[model samples]
Target: MESAELRELLTPEGVALLDSLPPYTSSTDVLKIVAGLRKDGYSASLVATVLTQAKLRGKAVAKFGDFAQRMLFTEAGLEQATRLPVAALHAGRYVRAGLTSVADLGCGIGADALAFAGAGLQVHAVDADEVTAAITTYNLSPFPEARVSHGKAEDTDLSDVKSVYLDPARRTSGHTNTNRLANAEDYSPSLDFAFGLAEKLPTGIKLGPGFDRDLIPDTCEAQWISVNGDVVEVGLWFGPLKRDGITRAALVMNAEGLHELTAATDSTDAEVGELGLFLYEPDGAVIRARLIGDLARSIGAHMLDEHIAYMSSDVAVSTPFASTFEVVHEFALDVKVLAKELKSRGIGTLEIKKRGVDIDPAEFRKRLSLSGKNSATLFLTRLGERRVAILAQRL
Candidate 1:
């Protein structure tokens, strides 16, 4: 959004109009609301701003929950903003470490800053973009101890700050149609500068979960976080922020709350063994943290293949680190034979899951001419050099 439009949106009259609008549901609903506002003599800019914010607020509910109603967001900012619950965890670290102040560099829309301030720490939130900085200032206005500045993160003053939080800009420059930058060097302020800051002071660097592991510093503690089964980001904690004896960690947050698995170093691969009666699929966070071996060992499971992440065990053991499945059938990978077998067993609906194979599940399903009364899951993968298919029921 343009600076002028944002300025208008923040006005009392505009905010009241935005608040008066019904919850945004679809494009047709938005169009009808816009038409009515225009008919009521609202300016074009005000109408556009209200509509944009209404739609953005609806989308923001997933990240900010009820607080989204009072927040403003840019499309890119909303996409990059950390979820409120996850940000609270980051803030809790600083609180536990006894850090009194933090500098949040590249603080998009001030989501993290708000969390830190709510935790009673002084926050210096900075964003290089004018609109983002303005929005951040507004978002943080309620906190007496928090401040916002429009400046480059690398150039921000940190002499008095007790610790730092860096979330580098990983998206291409644009107000729309932005793409993610896959290379670390492409990040604003650069990974090199960010790592240097971490080495000098207590710092937390938020990076994509798929970041290149080869470049991670040996002195830092890396934590992979997954929320509701999706691996979201990998956080590199440095100096005092790095917990004692913890070098690698996987933090899983689901409906049951947070569960963490930590190791002093990366776990070695579990020994490969024959397929057992049960299959275990390690959580994405566990796999990214390189703690799959630790998880396998905990459940007395062995790898199905040395190269693959799937695990197997004869006993039925329940664990939160992996999704367990009961094996029902196993056979050579032949589509015709599999289809005939499934048809005879009255299995119609299939959930095809594959790894170590090149077949597209949807296309393969279409070719099967499936028809039956039941449903089952099919796992097509290679057992060493031979192709195999395993039918299983999710536990």
Candidate 2:
């Protein structure tokens, strides 16, 4: 949004009109609302800006939950903002360390700043984008301890703040449509600057989960975090923020609660063996953290393929680090034979998992012509030197 549109949207009349409107939805008749607002004499800019916010709020629920209702967002800012639950964890690290204040550098939409403030830590949120900073100022108005400002992260003075958190802009400049910056050096604050902050104070840097491990500084603790089953971000913690005795960590948060796998270094790969009675699918976070060897040893499982992430064992074990499945059938990788077998077993609903192979599951499913009441997981992979299919049931 332009500064003028934002200026108008912050007016009492604008806010009231937004609040008074019915809940925005996918089916919302935006054209009708625009026509009605124009007839009511509201300025075109105000109407357009408010409507955009309403649509954003509807989509923001996935990230902000109930807080999205009162919050304002620029599309790019909201897209880059951390999920509330994850941001709360970041804030908790500061609270647990007994830090009273934090400076949020490149604080998109003030999501982390909100968490820090909610956790009772005084926060200064800085964003380079004028409109995003304004939106953050509005989002954080509820907390007097939280301050928002428009400024470049590299220029921000951090004399008073006890700790710093940086999530550099990994996308191109814009409030709406923007392209992702693939190179870490191209990040708004730059990786060198973000990493260099550790020398001055306790710091935490949030980067993409798939960040190059080789690029990670060995001096700090690197942690990959997953929500549900998706690996989200890797956090680099320095100084007092870094936990003792932990250099690498895979943190999985789901309905099963929080599960962590930590190691001093990437664990060595487990010894490969024959296909066992069960197959184990390592969680994405675990794979990203390279602790698959540690996880395999814990569950008495071995690598199904030396080069693959899949593991298997005769022992049936329960662990949050990996999903367990009971192997039901092993057959040739031929599609025609598999279809005939599946049809004979009355298997209908199927989940296809592939590794170390090239095949599209969607296209493969159509050829199966499946019809049954039962559901099964089909694994397409190599068992030693041969390519094979393993039909299994999730445990």
Candidate 3:
């Protein structure tokens, strides 16, 4: 059914009717429902409609809170669905820089639209899917002035857009085919196409955290955004209005968490590698910012390799900017011997990390007979000219 029809069916009475059906007790139940829906040719809109209706019928709200949370928001958009702090931050930055209007292409569910409107800027919210347009319209109900339209990203006119905001459809509707945008060329509304639109105005593109850095435009500024410690999204900024280079932003959001960041460019000094007593892995946001070298310098730590993301130092840094761990043991070589030694040490629990190593961590852990009492991290990597296993503990 169309979103309008779905909305009509969402009336309290209609919702109650659907809710009267059997409730899913667990993730398995939800999965089974999804599978059955898929088999029955149910669309994403239909699935969400069913789920929402189920929730409205009081589908064990307290007991299945996690499942409901994931189903309702995380799988939908969660905070991203609302696009509060991120959009607010972006809008505030641009507003400070004298930007006034935005063309939010692919404005799914109006998260950024509402943010832009709330920021007191005129916005043109566009989405290709009618259902998404409806969702955006509903989400932006409070912001009636934000113009929501349905059209392909390329078809949307950019005449009044001072800063074009693009959030490409990174995945298909079913949440399958995660690599949908693996190639800029593969994007239905391709990145190259978005870049073309961006070249005409100051542009911001909200991207997946796992996006390939090599493909991003050289002139654009890349930002990795993390909320409380989890990296959420990566945004690329373009035009003369933006600060040049990569910026890592650590945002603590609760409608009130203080935000701090480090914005560094490719021109910054190259970082050197040194093995210290402790090692650190920068948060996903920091890594996405392409400011690993800058962060290493700030922490007075060194990199494991110029290209690698790990940082090391003997000095303990209490900052939450990166995940810190202490190196408990190091081996020059020997997967088999190392495994045997760990097994003998009553180390049955293993968490393996690798950089430039092709071995599967799970398979390697399985090769060793590990027990639950001893949990250790095995870093398979190259330091200088040797393959080594460095055991580490969270610090």
Candidate 4:
């Protein structure tokens, strides 16, 4: 957001108006609210700012929960901010490690910094953007131990800090149209500088979940985290923050709670075996962390194909790391024949899953001519060189 818009939003009148506004429902609702405010003699700029904030708060619920209502956000800041539950986990690491003070470099809107302060740690939150820093200061106003600075992350003094948390800016400049920077060197503080800080002190560096595996340092612990089936971020822990003998880990969090799988070394791929009674699909975090073999061993399963992540087991087993499905039928992957078979079996609603193959599920679904009362999940994949289809029921 621009400075003038931010200044207006921070005014007492603006705060009162925003609080009085109802929760945003849709674009039409926003227009109606804006028009009503304008008709009530509120300035156009004030109405627009309040509407934007109302919209942002609605979107922020998934990340910050109820706390989002009191917080302000930029489009890009909210988009890249860490979820509150996940941020608590990050704070727990420092607390468990006996660190009391943290320097949160590149702290966007102070989301992670808020978590740190909430965990009772002193936080020095820094952001290069002026508007972002202002928002960060506002968001962190409740925590006296947390301070926001508008400056480059690399320029921040960390000599007195117990540890550091670096979340480099991974996108090019734009409020709502930001584009991701694919190269590590393109990050605001640069990966080299971030890694250097890690080498100097106990540090946690957050990067994209799909960060290059080869670029990871051998001395640090790399943990990939997923929330509600979506792989979110990979955190690299160095120095005192690194867990002993655990170089890689996968942490999955859902409504049930958080579960973690770790390995001291890279896990060897599970051996390929014939299709068994049940098929399993490992969580995305497991695949990203290369811990599929460990998960497979825990459930007495084998890989369905050497090159594929799908696993097969003779017995049905419940595991948090993977979703289990019972195999109902196996057939050669012929679209016309498969469509005929599905129709004959009275299968109508279908969920198509594919791996190690080239097929557009949506386009292919149109050709199936689906019509029935039954629902089934179909897996289109390769068994060695042969293309195959496995119809399964979710367990």
Please provide, for model 2 over 146-254, each residue's C-alpha lDDT reduced to its tens digit, 9 standing for 90 to 100: 8888999999989989999999888899988999888888998989998889888899999999888999988888999998898889999998888998899999999
Lowest-sum lDDT 10-residue window in model 3: 66-75
TM-score of candidate 2 relative to the true fold: 0.94
- Can you write out model 1's per-residue Cα lDDT over 159-236, one digit (the tens) per residue? 989999999999997555789997889999799899999878899999899999998899989999999889989999
lDDT of 4 at 148: 87
* Model 3 ranges with Cα > 4 A deviation: 1-12, 15-48, 52-83, 172-179, 210-215, 228-230, 244-264, 267-274
TM-score for each of the candidates: 0.96, 0.94, 0.77, 0.97
- Which one wins by TM-score: 1 or 4? 4
Each candidate's lDDT (Cα)?
0.90, 0.92, 0.68, 0.92
- Angstrom error of the Cα, residue 324, model 4: value is 0.8
Higher-TM-score candidate of 1 and 3 = 1
Note the clash tally of each candidate: 0, 0, 2, 0
lDDT over C-alpha atoms for residue 33 of model 2: 97
Top TM-score hit? 4
On residues 78-191, what C-alpha lDDT tens digit does candidate 4 reach at each position?
A: 999999999999999999999999999999988899999999999999999999999999899999768889999989988878899999999997557799998888998988
* Model 2, C-alpha of 166: deviation from truth (Å): 0.4
Question: For model 2, where is the 10-residue window of minimal lDDT?
Answer: 17-26
State model 1's lDDT.
Answer: 0.90
The regions of model 2 sitting more than 4 angstroms off are none
